[model samples]
Target: MTFSIVARSADGRLHGVAVASKFLAAGALVPAAEAEVGAVATQAHVNLAYRSQGLALLRTGVAPADVVAGLTAADPGRDERQLGVVGSTGDGATWTGSFCHPWAGGQAGDGWAAQGNILVGPQVIDAMRDAWLDGSELPFPQRLLTALRAGDRAGGDRRGRQSAGLLVVRRRGGYAGTGDELVDLRVDDHPDPVTELGRLLDTHTMLFGKPDPATLYDLTGPLADEVAALLAAAGHPVGVAGLDGALASWAGVENLEERIVAGRLDPIVLEHLRRTAPPGRTGD
Candidate 1:
């Protein structure tokens, strides 16, 4: 009993999946993706093979449709399976077996494929597709979960909500992480899985995420009022407040660049300071 959104980024450089279900730790079972390959979701008599094989196909230059074809060809029980795939090219597809269960079905579109089984009705898939097209229009993880939330609102996983998970990959680090596996957050078990998933994603994006390096700076000379004003304008009060502390804490340090790099302040805050201050006030 689950609902899932498998998608590739509009620009075709990223791939991700978000899934929620009445099952325990849905994230552990439902989603898989790689930055250079694509994404896959296997649910409703879920087969783990789809995870490795599907990605291998996409990595080997197979299209989404062909990946499904090849996968189904090898799995005689394909008709009883609910699956979704997105290729590196952004091609998407879904399959819902006629014998799946009541209220079971799915939809495929431009860059995403949404599907669910043992739900309230086709509305599950319908709401997912609509939300994907009409939601916040943010990046992949946000958009994908928005679609999943829509399905949850429509009555997801006939068994009820227990867990949710999100996976995203890109060529470079996302708002968090040091590599292409941008977001791999999951709510293994929750009474309100969708809400929990959203909360987790929001928190993950804001706090633990890596800040832009270009915003790092050096604070030389006396603190400038213009610097505070600039930092305020650019949305960083931390840097403005911490300039004196950074200099004082790091005995005799004049440049913000060295202070920031030496762990005197938050990198993101330092980066903001570098950007907002006038030229040469800090390294950009």
Candidate 2:
């Protein structure tokens, strides 16, 4: 009915899960994670208790296998459950109940566990693992989504796709300069939810992402000359305007590093601005 990947990031500061299912909005039932703790996915006769209980156990230093055992032991319907877990140390574990639907089984490895039940044979899970291993260079959420896409391509959800979800978190928001959740996006129900999820993530990044340190603009020359050119080029028409205008101009078309790397703006232009822009406050 569903396939999911639970993983701990290489830097050990993130934990997340990506899942898609034909079981209505799978996001509401599957995929749970806590920053710096671990992640869990429960499906195929899912025991909802596993969500909070699994996080609690991981928070208390419990191992992935132990968490699985504890959750299963408390569930009367354990024989119909399919579950996967990845602990903070990258330890991975999975379980497929003996009484789960057709084509029910799973595979587990060092950093991830892939599982699904009903239809599509074991290739669904296999393709998910293979995609993750192949996409190792991508970010954790991207890697997880890549795996989900692979399973979907390999004939996912013995039933069909109805909902998809992605959850990720780190010590800090990793942007917006806060100690809050980093990534919290979900597609509760949609004919093409994965695509929608990606769109939302992109929008979130544009608004919340802070400029990378390597991209931060630093100056080394006269502020007057630099401000003058920036104002002229921006069609500000009005020279230097004010402190707000100067700072806003500083964060111009190419002043942000991510934009430069993304080819959305010219890197040389950003570099020049960094070397000459003035110091001041700015806001949206």
Candidate 3:
């Protein structure tokens, strides 16, 4: 009752998984990844151990196919479990257990794996694989989610959708470079979980994404005046000369500190300020 994609970025520094299932809180169980190691998706009978154990195996430089072999080889219930894995290098691997419900299988290539069990049909995995291949130029997280959305549109889980998740890991890529979780989002339960996941991903990008140097706007002229007005309306009054500290304070309160630059601003942060500028007070 699930579909998923596990992949490693072209440069081998990013690893991630995107999954959706008819099961409740599948996000809490089905997907796992470690920066510079690999990613895994375990569903159908759902062997939670496969997540950590698979990452450990990948950490040891095991090929993804061997990882799948070693994992299922040790489980007595292997025939009821489905698994997909992608390592930091070489081809990915996928397995569909014999006892899994009908219309179940998977596909794998150089850097990705797409799999599903009790899906509407093979088209789900087919669409996912095609999307992953065609999205080689997309940002890693967006590529994974794009593949997932393609599968959903192609007829996902036969039972329906309940939960969906996106997880991407990169070395020191977490918030403020303090962790490895670049994007970890879950829609535990929603009427349209995939779409909700996309919305949350956008919010994550805006709040936690790094500033593009080319898009940074120096605090000057009209932009500076507008920011000062917006800050004042938000109750954090500031003069042009004091924009830096005041903006930082406002950003911290709004949980946007990660997007703040010392003497410049990210357009995303500016858009957010205008969006939340108390309606008519925004000055259009």
Candidate 4:
């Protein structure tokens, strides 16, 4: 019926779950997480309590395996349920009930867990793990989605795809540094929900992502002149302080000021300006 991955980032600053199912609105029910606690995916029998209950247990400093044990023990329908959890420290655990459909089992290792039911062969689950292992270079949400795509390529939901959901939590990673719901994207129903989810993620990135220090562009000398000129052409003030102020305002509107240094610039922001400004505009 579904396949999913739950993981904590290698740096332990992020945790998330990506799930796709033949059912509609799978994301709303199958994935759950907290900023510094952990993440869990409960499917098969689909225990709704596992979402809040698991987080509560994780918040109490319990291990993921124990959390699974406690949750399952309290539910009489445990035999039909599937559960996966990843702790804040990157420890992971999974449980597949005996009554779950064929090809229904899971694997848990280190910082991630993969589980599915009523679908392809064991290879689907394996492909997800392999994808997660191979995606160290990607951001945590992207990596989780990559793993979901791998499972899909391996024949994800036997019944077919209808909906998919991704939920990621990071410290102060929400809109405007408010909460921790970093990326809560969902394709409630679609012909190809995975690809649709990707599209949404791209839009979210441009609006919310911060530039990495490894890719920063310090504004000084001739580069500053070029940027100032570009700003002016874009109808922003061209003075030194005014340019920075305008860029800051732009960044604020986009919710992308995290990568900005008050006095410097980020190359990614410049690239954004170049690409999104106008047809006749060009800047290096």
Best by lDDT: 3
Ordered from best to worst lDDT, the candidate numbers read: 3, 4, 1, 2
Return the number of clashes found in candidate 1.
5
Evaluated at residue 155, the lDDT of candidate 4 is 95
Q: Which residue pairs show collisions in model 2?
A: none
Task: State every prediction's TM-score relative to the real structure.
Answer: 0.76, 0.77, 0.96, 0.88
Please, what is the whole-model Cα lDDT of each candidate in the order they appear?
Answer: 0.76, 0.75, 0.93, 0.88
Q: What 10-residue stretch in candidate 2 is worst by lDDT?
A: 257-266
The best candidate in terms of TM-score: 3
What is candidate 1's lDDT per residue for 1-284, written digit by digit as tens? 88899988877888899999888998999899988688999998898999999999989989888888888889988888989999877559888776787778878877789988889888888888888988647766789888888889988887888999999888876532357878888888889989988998876664445435565444443434444444544434435447454333332232223223333245544444555455543323
Candidate 1, which segments miss by more than 4 Å at Cα?
Answer: 174-177, 210-284
Which residue pairs does candidate 1 place in steric collision?
Answer: 215-271, 216-271, 218-256, 218-257, 219-256
lDDT of 3 by residue, 1-284 (tens): 89999999999999999999998988899999999999999999999999999999999999999999999999999999999999999999999999999899999999999999999999999999999999989989999999999999998998888999999999999988999999999999998999999999988987888889999999889998899889888878785649998899899998899989998999988988988877667444
Residue 138 C-alpha lDDT in model 1: 79
Model 4 pairs whose backbones collide: none
Report the Cα lDDT for residue 268, model 4: 71
**Candidate 4 residue-wise lDDT, 1-284, digit = tens:** 89999999988899999999999999999999998789999999898989999999999999999999999999999999999999988469999999999889999999999999998789999999999999999988899999999999899988888999999999899977898999999999999998899899888887678766777777878877777666655666465667678677666665667657766777778787666554454254
- Those runs of model 3 whose alpha carbons end farther than 4 Å from true positions after fitting are 239-241, 279-284
Worst lDDT run of 10 residues, candidate 1, spans 250-259
* Clash count, one per candidate: 5, 0, 0, 0
Report the candidate with higher lDDT, 2 versus 4. 4
